[model samples]
Target: MSEGVTLDRTGGLITLGAADTLWADLMADSAVPTASAALTSFPAHARMGYVLLGDRVVATVKTGSSQWSVLEIEVRQAAAELNAVEMDRQDLVRIGPFRSAAKQEPMEGTALRWRQRITRALQERGGLERAAREDARPYHLAGIDWRRILVEQTRDRTVRTWWLPRAAVRVLDAAEHTETQWLHAARACQASAVVTEPSSHHQQVPALGSRPTTSPDCPTAPLRPYNGELQGHLYSVLSRKPGTSRRVAGWACAVCRTTPATVLDHCHEHGYVRAPVCQSCNTQERPDHLYSNDIRVADHYRRLFDTHAADWLRHWHRCPGCRARTTLPLPHLAAWTAHIACRSLRPTHRDARSSRARKPCGVLRVSWTGSHSAPRSCLLTVAVDFCPSGEHRVLAQVPYREAAEQFRSWLAETAPAVAAAAGPDRLDDLPTRPRPVIADTSSDGLALF
Candidate 1:
């Protein structure tokens, strides 16, 4: 009971160690607050969000940060230059020195060593799971972890406390995300494995569903009636015999080429059904995502506009007149050919101009005035506000398919086009110059889409 160590002392100020605080009552003074006011020690804090949680790894990265990456990767011998098991998540490529996207210079191999270190650390903490599971949150704090912040209180009675944060945590039933929007960023590591360099990639995991439980966009829409083709497809999927013939799960994601596409990512503007992108496409390739502008992406959108422009009218969720996502079902598809009124079976109270406008962007305007034949287009510019090297973006219309192999043709043709394209050219190619948000740039061509 006599074990005592004075942590602090003032006019009435006093602090106690954990032992002192526990047995202070046995001492002469029990009324004094025993909570350590001037705290010293701190716990380990994992730098990144991907921390282990009892056989699970919760993790998160900046959304849309992964333009392209491997789904899974493994290193064999921890040599100076080790070959990765899976490269680009498609082909197995050896780890050359990772290049700086801006300088295009080969970087150090220590990057892999760090990855090896962290992989081992994760195993020491716990481990990760690979198979996809349904019940997942954008962020997670697995369980009630036994950790606390040792706070240092200031001299004044006002109780100014300096907290030493050691780790990431979150509260339950709150808006708190544990820096971990998700916890599935770990691969099973070999007990003897070593990393000669640092590494990373987005492995295949459960995607953000059509109506994610939580996202920045609030007030999620409820499930509504879909078009006949989609409904029929769903019906076919539902009606299929268990463990037999081809299923919708066999569909591949057009974007990433992941098999068994889970959801359809359609453009809100045109409502044209684009393609069977891997279900992850719905979560990752969100609408309003500005493509860096490339020929392939432009061609993708153009084909959608050309093939299924009128498909929205077939769905029960369109305004029909304006072709927006509303409960009001428009009776007829907007007339593509000019000089014809929107021939709807029911009265929509819209006029001929609403009916005849070509390539409507779904946004209703007071009056429609533009070249009726051309499809809508926009320019997508990425990177920081200040760009020293040339900033290249393209306005996407159906016609620019021939525009410079890489839209360098259309980039010069028009400054303003619909949102499409990715990456910029390295005309200046000044590696020493300051530019922000550059993934990769080359005088040869861009690699984004």
Candidate 2:
């Protein structure tokens, strides 16, 4: 363990690892000796690097008491300390990186107003400086990587706006690509999982796209760019596999893990073909930049992207979180950042939400007409409120309300009648409702006979 790993209860510097709970730290019995002396000092501080919600600076809260993080702590004290540093977190507006694979322009007009407002608000108390990370080794390109020019204005009293691109990141060697380097990391992940046999794992591998400068392999070379024709490109990539490069096999969205991979998601940073993503993931994952809130998170993302993403199927299905988050759609950097930070305040949030449930105010039986060949059956839900919504909205979020119980019970009672009457709709509404019902002659449900 390094000297910096020491935890002094008196000094009140409580740095909890992703796995470490402050509760455990405080509740631990006094001065009991253990086999592993190092664990008492450094309790697993590092975690897998991930694509975090935002470019966040850790706001360390200090109190004389080590138990300051406990739920029972006085809100006034926690708020006072946290507000001094993190209250302005929401108001901190970002500037620049105004370019893409397409446009390369500095923040101007509407984008220009924010910095001026921040500077104006600062007055004489503080000034701004363009801080550079000593360790950021930018990839050599023909022109300035305009997309990399991201500046986030800090909300502290001094109000510092930093153009910190890849600052303080112990990234891979400049010559090596993330994909090429991920093999080892994948092995580490597999090894940790204690798999007796080798099986691929990629729950959250990034669906990055490719650049001309990026390495063209069996996996990457066939994958089309985001701007290209999707279905046609998918066909080309699938059909045109050479002896050197295996066909890019998986056809599922990288993020959602369920939808047919519609678009080729590229790494915003390296311009490498990361993975295939559905239109939904492509539409929502707005930030071209792959975000990492902490070193561990970033490292995990790199390793995952480099390894699992190369195998599209394993990447999409391995981790359950990636599959689940698709519907909930933690979506992008902004949402994930807010979500993790807000978790600490869940005790308070729970208390605040103890009011009456927002149950269905009223229910409607709006009929939806669709073709017989329509692919979805989740549309015909019994408990629905008037949202002027369609099948997608219902499938996505709108849940069964508390007030829907009575109607649902009645509907359940009527299920036998509904099944009996399912034979033919007497053309009361639709012109095609009276169509003849085909007999299922086969004993098996497949109707092949």
lDDT of each structure? 0.24, 0.26
What TM-score against the true fold does each predicted structure earn?
0.20, 0.19
lDDT for model 2:
0.26
User: Which ranges of candidate 2 are over 4 A from the true structure?
Assistant: 1-225, 229-275, 278-379, 382-449
Candidate 1 residue lDDT tens string, 1-449: 23443322211112223322322233222111111211111111122322222112222222234321111110001110111111122111111111322344332421112222322323343322221133132211222121122233333564222221211111111111211122111221323337886654533222322212222222222222222333212223333446321222334444444233434433332233444433223322231112212111212222223443223212222212122211111111111110011112112233456665433212110111222222222121112111223222111222212221333332223322211222233122322311121211121111111
| Candidate with maximal lDDT | 2
Question: Candidate 2 residues 1-449, lDDT tens each?
Answer: 32333445533233333112332232233121111211112111112221110111111232444322111121122223222321211221133222221232343321112223233323333322222222232211111121133344554554444332221110111111222223334455556665577654422222222121121221222223322223212223433446312222224345555343434543221122445554434433332222121111122232223333334323332222222221111112222222222223222212235574333222222122223222121122222234344321221111212212322333234333322322223223322211221221111111000
lDDT over C-alpha atoms for residue 421 of model 1: 21
Residue 210 of candidate 2: its Cα lDDT? 17
